[model samples]
Target: MKQKIRDILAKHGGLPTPVDQLADDADLYAAGLSSFASVQVMLGIEDAFDVEFPDNRKSFQSIDAITKAVSGLVGSTEAAE
Candidate 1:
């Protein structure tokens, strides 16, 4: 799951530093993740994982947070067994 999330970040993060180089808890805003890029990343994550993000945007703060939110959505009780 983390690897897939990393792949999404790598493809859409648009950071000055490579996504591979950033720590999971890295401050993505400080690393150059603009609001526009965050929207792109969110769309990419939804497409990749088949999970819709919540209406809130706070979970887009970092790769770790995004991964956790995606995992929960994808693993929800509403999901198929």
Candidate 2:
């Protein structure tokens, strides 16, 4: 899942420094992520995961946070199945 996030970011803006070299727990916004780029990243995530972003979950605006949010959606979807 982390790799998928990295791939999504890479596809959009290429290597964002080397902070991506760090763990998924690393704060991406602190590691050179920009606000505008974050929206694009979020869109890519939605596409990759086929998960809809709820307006209430808009609080998840960081890579790590998005990962957790996506994880939650996956769990919920699996439970529904």
Model 1 residue 42 lDDT score: 88
Report model 2's TM-score to 2 decimal places: 0.68
lDDT for each of the candidates? 0.80, 0.64
Q: Which 10 consecutive residues of model 2 have the lowest summed lDDT?
A: 55-64
Judging by TM-score against the true structure, name the best candidate.
Answer: 1
Model 1 lDDT per residue over 1-81, tens place = 777777887788788898888898888888898898888888998898788887767787777787678868888553332
lDDT (0-100) at residue 73 of candidate 1?
89
Per-residue lDDT of 9 in model 1: 79
lDDT of 2 at 15: 37
